[model samples]
Target: MADTILVLAWLVLAHLAADFILQSASIAAAKSGHGSRALAGLFAHGWIVAAVVVPVGFAFGERGWWFVLLTGLSHIAIDRAKVVLTRRAAAAALREAHDRHEAPRPPEHLGRAWTPQPAALFLADQGAHLAAASGGWAVLLAGVPLDPGWTAAIDGWLGSWDRVAVHGVASAAVVLIGLAIVNIRAASLFVGILVRPVEVTAGGEHRWGGRVAPAPDPDIRSSTSAAQAPVGRRWSIRLGPLDARVIAEPEPAIASPASPSTPPLGGSARVGSTIGVLERILIVVFVLTGTDVAIGFVVAAKTLARFRLLDDRDFAEYYLLGTLASVAIAIVSALIGRAALGALLA
Candidate 1:
């Protein structure tokens, strides 16, 4: 049973790494497009998945190759299904909006107070992939023994380390690595989808607190020439089931004086994402080591760094929603890791 669990963990870790870490942004975007580019992306992604899975399969023995074949094919099939479903849903949405005489919003920007269609689709896609992985494990690899040569090599490499201690360490490492990947890459994608930026017309009415509200900032119109100025924007921060707030967008690039020190938009987003990854990693470490209270310090320090920006209700709500989501995911991942570690070590 223990060996089965370890093998299952390796399979899951391989899947997560390939899907989120190894797959580049360009490849991910290309996969959603049409024709030859999409096929190329899918093939590239398949190779990546194979790269991660093949080594693990070989480590377990020849029979494990069957697991590799099952998992890899299922991944591609699931992804293709997701693409077809998303495109069909989008076309349907456009037709509905046309019939109602309403402007069609992109799927990513569909819902103001609820989960966006893109986010829901993303979750479903991932859920399907994971289910496939789990099902493959049960069918072909559930009772298979690890290769004797591989086990001997691991033991020899560890030298004088006690066997029980080595097993404990291996289990802990697997759990920690899996948790880190999910908390960092996967959570970033999820939160970004949920809190995507919204565009509105300058000085036009927009939804706020379940009602239409006029733009509050009178000086926004004079910030720049019409060509340079962006339309008004709002970020809907859903605080809870019954509570949501719309915050004004940050000053447009045209309004801010450009400096060599300023990062480009993409660079800025990358930096923010890096910070989020580090923050979640620290929280996971704190929770795993029985220093959960230290997680508070992590949150406090992050909030302090952006203290001045918090004065803007818009930025504050956006920041709060993101931070809360990050912290929640990290904490939950840590608790699960701790439980798995305890059970394995026992």
Candidate 2:
């Protein structure tokens, strides 16, 4: 049973390591295009799964390469599905937007900005990978083949409880720590990029979150110029769901020469990053200590902090999504760590 649990952990660890840590920006960009590069990245993920499962199979006493084969094949299928579905959805959105481009629509449609595609696709991709992993776990639990020799290696990796006290370290302990760090560091980047609004700039090109893109040729008229009627000439584009028109809103005019004006972008990057790390830490600590109710206090505190700003539905949704994502990541890490620690202690 302990071995079974370990196998499950290994699958999850491998999934995280491969999907987030190992995947490069170039690969992710390529995967978005649904081209040969997408296939290549998908294949790369399969190899990663195979490498992890093979050695674990040896230790977990699984005979032959059935585990590897089963896991790798399933992982490939899931990844391919993720790639295809995301691409298709995006393409369909483009087509729809083209049809609606000429239609009269209001500027700054608050409700449209909150449509969750990029975020949803991301979550769905991860969920499918996890489900595939569960299938592999089920197979292992059924008792395929085991090499008892693998126990020594497994034991070494987990480390003994007393030895950990003296040495101030344990393999499983370190793995958990790394997992928490990676979740905050890398996963945040993914979420940030996904949720970040793509603003249609003056040149009709998209920029992330603001009107900071290089000014297009001042003499050249963009097709979007006509669409700027609602928000004056100075405005920013906030993109909506797949194929949805960009929402333009007027940038606030400066009140006075002496008064500092707020940039439409809003929020301090450094401060937000700091808050994210702190929240993840708080969630993990609260979960492991068995004071889960404290998690609610944390949530309430965050809500109260932002309650004054809820009038802006777009910003509110962004805050809400980010908060939920942070809490979810912490909860998952804490639960996995707790389980692994228990088995190691037992």
Candidate 3:
């Protein structure tokens, strides 16, 4: 039974490693200006997980194999679940934005078919988890003892029953981390809204509305030279910036609240201001996490700046502060993950 579990775990780990790296790479690719280094690094993370598990499998023999397999499955399952949930949320948000006439121009490649980056990323994540679950189970079922008498070789490190406990803990930690990330993201969004207001006008009236932010630099529009024109309008077609309706409204009261009391964090924050704060936070977090923060940062800045969230120079400063906060959070998250893993395993 132990050997079977061990083999399964190793297989799952292998599948998960491949899936995560590929998913991360895909996400990095879809966003603009994410450097090759960042992309390569994301693609490399799976290798680290793989490296740690392979040797353990070899050392503990059957038991070790089962441990690795089970742990791997757990990792994959948690990640996959998170991806599914996140994707659903992102898709809903995108649909709402589109319906409300607030959707950004989809990059040329996306046209009407393009889904949000988060949805794509989540799908990739789900793929990795699915591979781990099915592949790991298959490998274990195929061979009774992944290695006959393999459990005796290294009684030193894992020491029998400890292997199962360790793996159980590790798997749990992975799931917890996924849950934490989702929560943090949601909390960050709420916090952002509490601090700023976006100025959205519907027709001629001021309608303060928050929007689904876009990436700062999206895949640029495709070159017209390569675009195949539709059959009918070839000669008489004129391509130019479409005329946007202009409306004038009274200058919104720029004055601070009379009592100078700041609202509680994340509640009733104005749309433009909220985006500004959110972008600043994300920029800082991205730098610290060394993750490719998406074009949401750029959109937030542009929208907020357009609505007078901050003057140009002040916006720059706000982003700088946001970076610092993100770095701190990244460190804390890492530490918490490490501790959580240790506790679960121990």
Candidate 4:
């Protein structure tokens, strides 16, 4: 029992530390606020690690908590290696510039400033998991346990065949850990939305970085922007791919009490409806299984809703909804498979 507690402690600490370090590295490399992207990337990478660890853990006896602890530490190490390599490459770019006597040009800004591709995020996530796993294995060697099951499992990894229990608590542990990482990434994205926007002056023009402040209550716009309407109204709702329009309405003496300052794209009620649909899909998938199509539907719906790509808040919300939606589809797919089997048996 004492050993079990130690192993659990190691898991939590390793997860927290790896998450922080990987995110920091991502921020440094991306040269922008992609914190949420980093979180999602880390979660995706952890799943890749689990692919190896799950089989290995099953081969080894499921008794010792050491296996999991080691995997977590190794994950940390892999991430660190990736980060180090990335920095070195970036530095080399600067070194070449310096050698030529030309000013070391800052890294060129890529296609989109705020947007990041999903695949990059996934790769970053894998790096993080690798680092953690590396670190974890080192720790495990220091206080190893004896178990006949584990010995057999390691042999299996060495190409020996073994009839280890493939579908059981051990498998569930891997799935649950993956789910937890996804959840953490989603939660982190949600929090990143709340960070304050920075003000900057460049090229003799002033602009807000990251996000624009919420527009004043529509009703108070008469007093606030008496001569001109608020600026964000241009992107309030896009009529087409490029065209935008301002939505005007009579200003009430007092705005609705429930409306938050940053009215979150849609009103509160619409947001709730979107959130409900996402949660339903997740619950269904968890109970069932393998519902990628349904999950894809949810992902598409949320992405479309992101038409209001006016600020970082909208971007974060879009990804959060997508994450939940994908999970739901997976659960639904699994449920479908089970039902098919039941019918065949009948």
Each model's RMSD to truth, in Å?
Answer: 13.1, 10.7, 15.8, 16.5
Stretches > 4 Å off in candidate 1: 59-63, 86-115, 147-162, 197-271, 307-313
Q: Write the residue-wise lDDT of candidate 3 on 150-228 in tens digits.
A: 5555445466657666778656645354434422552243323222212112111111112222222121111111121
**Between candidates 1 and 4, the lDDT winner:** 1
Q: Candidate 2, residues 24-108: lDDT per residue as tens digits?
A: 6556555444457667866777787777667756755543367677777787887667656644443343334434553321122
**lDDT of all predictions, in order shown?**
0.65, 0.57, 0.40, 0.38
My TM-score estimates for the predictions, one after another, are: 0.67, 0.64, 0.32, 0.32
Please give the distance, in angstroms, between residue 64's alpha carbon in candidate 4 and its true position after superposition.
Answer: 10
- CA shift of 276, model 3, Å: 23
lDDT top scorer: 1
The candidate, 3 or 4, that scores higher on lDDT is 3
Mark the regions of model 3 whose C-alpha exceeds 4 Å error after superposition: 1-39, 55-124, 140-150, 157-346
- Candidate 1 lands at a TM-score of 0.67
lDDT at position 150, candidate 4: 58
Going through the candidates in the order shown, the clash numbers are 0, 4, 29, 52
- What's the lDDT for candidate 4? 0.38
Candidate 2, which segments miss by more than 4 Å at Cα? 60-64, 92-114, 148-175, 178-182, 185-190, 197-267, 300-308, 332-340, 343-346
lDDT by residue (1-346, candidate 1, tens digit) is 2376666676778888999889986787677666788788788888888778896576667667877877777788888877766555434433343345443132223222222454567689888987888887777767777778777787688899897877778887888789978987798877665544222223322221111112223233222123334457666665567666676765544211112233222455576678889999999999889999899899999989889888876567667877887888899888978887777777
